[model samples]
Target: MTLNASLLKQGAACGQEGVPPPPLLLSLLDSSHHILCVSHVSPDGDAVGSLLALGSILRAQGKRPTLALQDEVTSEFQFMPGAEKIIGPAEVAHSYDLIVCLDTSSIDRIGTVYIPEIHNQIPLVVIDHHVTNTLFGTDNWVDTGCAATCQMLVRLADALGVPLSEEIAFSLLTGLVTDTLCFRTANTDTNVLQAALRLVNAGASLEFVVRNTLDSRSLGLVRLWGVGLANVQMEEGIIWATLNAESRQRSGVEPHQSDGLANFLVTVREADISATFAQRFANNGQELIECSFRAKPGFNVSQVAYSFGGGGHPPAAGCTVSGSLQEVSARVVAALRELRRQSVDGDSG
Candidate 1:
C-alpha cells in the first residue's frame, strides 16, 4: 500500500493519459504522514466527492487523512460514502505534514477549513479542475480539461499505485454524475465516460449514484424553488431570480437548498444565461448574496464569475457579493445581459 514518488516521475497512469499529476504532488503524498483534505464552502457533489475520495486514497497509502468541509454536506449527497465523517474547521488539528485542497478554485474557497496562519505553514497541494484556480498550493495539479476533480483523483490513484476501493469508486463516481448532470454536460467527453465506466466496473453503482444525487432533493428545496421561480425575470436573453432572506425563511429552506435555482432558470427556452442570487450570512453574520450562474453550451459564465472575484467553468460559475438581495441581483443581471450580448455578437461576427 506504500507507493513511491519515483513512480509518479515515471509518468504512470496516475493522472489519466493526458493529465499527469506533478511528481512533487506525489512526493508530498509519499512523504507526509498526516494530511488534511478539504473542498469548497457550500460544497456540491464534486467538492464533497473529491474530499472523501482523497481521504480514502490517503488511507490506502497508510497515511492519516483528515477530511474537512466548511459547510455541511447537503441531504442530497449525504448518501455518498463517508459523507458523514467529514469534519468542520473547529475540529481540524493544528498540525499536519501536508494539506491537499480538492475541487477548490482558490484558498479562500475552502473557507475556514484552511487557516492561513496555521495550515498555510504546511506544504499544500492543490488538485482541481476549475480554470479559475489561483495555483495557490505549493505543489499544484490542476487539470481544467478533467470534467471534475474526482476524475483527476482517479488518475492520481493509478499514479500512486493504489487500487480503486469500492469506497473510492463510489465517492468519485458521485462527483462525476452530479457535476456532469448524468453525462449530459458539454464537458462530458469520452474520457469522462471512460473513467465512469471504470468506476462502475470497480463496483460503484451508477444507478445508486444518480438516484441519490441528481434525482433527489428535499421538499424544502422544492418550496424554495417555488419562491425563486415566482420572482424570475428575463432581459435580453438573460434570466435571473432572487431568493432573499425573507423568502428563504418563509419557505423553510437552507441557503444551500436555495441553490441550483440558477441552473433551473437556464432551462427556459428563451434564456441563454441564468443566475440566482441567494442571501447568506458570513461567519461575522453580515448579510451577503451568493450568486450562482449557468449558461448554455456556447455561452460562457466563467468570465463574468471571474470578473466578480469568483471562478468556475464556462457554462457554470458564481461569486459572492455584498448588498441587498435586490441590489446584488440587479447588478449581476446587468452583467449577465452584457455577457449574453457579446456572446451573441461574437457568434454572428
Candidate 2:
C-alpha cells in the first residue's frame, strides 16, 4: 500500500472512533533534495526531538541531512541523537535544495543570526503542530490539534513503512511527553495515547525519557527557578516573571536554563494566563528578550504573541521582543491586558 493510502485508512478509522489521528508528513520527505532541518531558538524538547527524529528518517532514506540551528544546542539537548551534527548558521553556505523547518511557526523565529545561501530560493517544507503557524512553507504539514511534531513524525514513519528503531522511538516519545506536559495538556487525545503506546511497543522507554528530560536539572537551573518564581508578578489574573541577564549571571544560569519557567507560572491558582520573559544582554551592546506565553482554555495567548512577531499553539506560544527587558516586558504586559480586556468586553456583549 502507498503511504497516502495507509495514512488515509488510519485517519478514517480514527475519525470513526472519534480520535484525533496524527497527520502524515513523510510524503513531502521523499522528494526533498538536500534537507535542512531547523527548530526554534533556544530549543526545547519538542524542537530537539522533532529535528533529530526527522533528520534520522531523511538520512535513513539516503538523503544528505544537515541539522541547522540558530546557535549551538544547550547542555540540556546534548543527549538527543544528532545533536553533535548540528551546523551553526555561520557554517551554512550551500543552498539547501529543501529546508524542513520544524517546531518554529515563522521563518524569523528559526533564529538564525546569519542567512544561508539557499539555492533557487528552494522550497521550504514546514512541519509543525503550532496553531500560530503562518503557513510560510511552500509545502506545509500542520496539524494544530496534534500534541507534538514528533507525534506527527511517528505517523509519517508508519506511512513510509519504516519500522521504528529504539533511537527513533525515543526521540519521538521525548517530544510527545514534554510537549504534552507528561500528558497534562488539554490537547492530549486518545490517538496521541495510542501513538505513545506504539512508541513503547517499538522499544521507546517512556520512564527513562521522562525521568531524564523533566526530572533531571542542574543546581543552577533550580536556583534560576527560584529567581523566576520570586519575581513572579500577578495582575488582573495574569502572572508573569522576568529573568534579566544580570539575574541569570548571578544565579549562574544560562538562558535556556530557565526553560520551564513560563509553565511554572501557569500553576498559580490565580493566573488565567502566564508568561516568562528572558532578557539576554549581549556583549556586543545589543539586547533581545525571549517571551514565553501560556494560558488556560479561554485565553488566546497565541494570537497575542503573534501580534508581537511570535507564534505557537493557542495554549502555549512565544515571541521574541527586541530591546531591553524592561521595554519588552511593558509591551507584553500591555498586550496581555488588552487581551484580557477584550475578552471581558466580549463576554459582556
* Candidate 2 lDDT for residue 77: 67
lDDT digits (tens) for residues 167-227 of candidate 1: 8999999999989989988989999999999999999999999888777877878888988
Model 1 score (lDDT): 0.84
Clash-forming residue pairs, model 2 = 95-119
Q: Residue 309's C-alpha lDDT in candidate 2?
A: 87
Q: How many backbone clashes does candidate 1 have?
A: 2
All candidates: CA RMSD (Å): 4.1, 5.0
Clashes of each: 2, 1
Residues 191-291 of candidate 2 have per-residue lDDT tens digits of 88998999999898889988888778778888888888887888898899989888788877677557588787888888888988888866787898888
Q: What's the true lDDT of residue 179 in model 2? A: 93
TM-scores for every predicted model: 0.93, 0.87
lDDT for each of the candidates? 0.84, 0.77
Deviation from native of the Cα of residue 255 in model 1, angstroms: 2.2
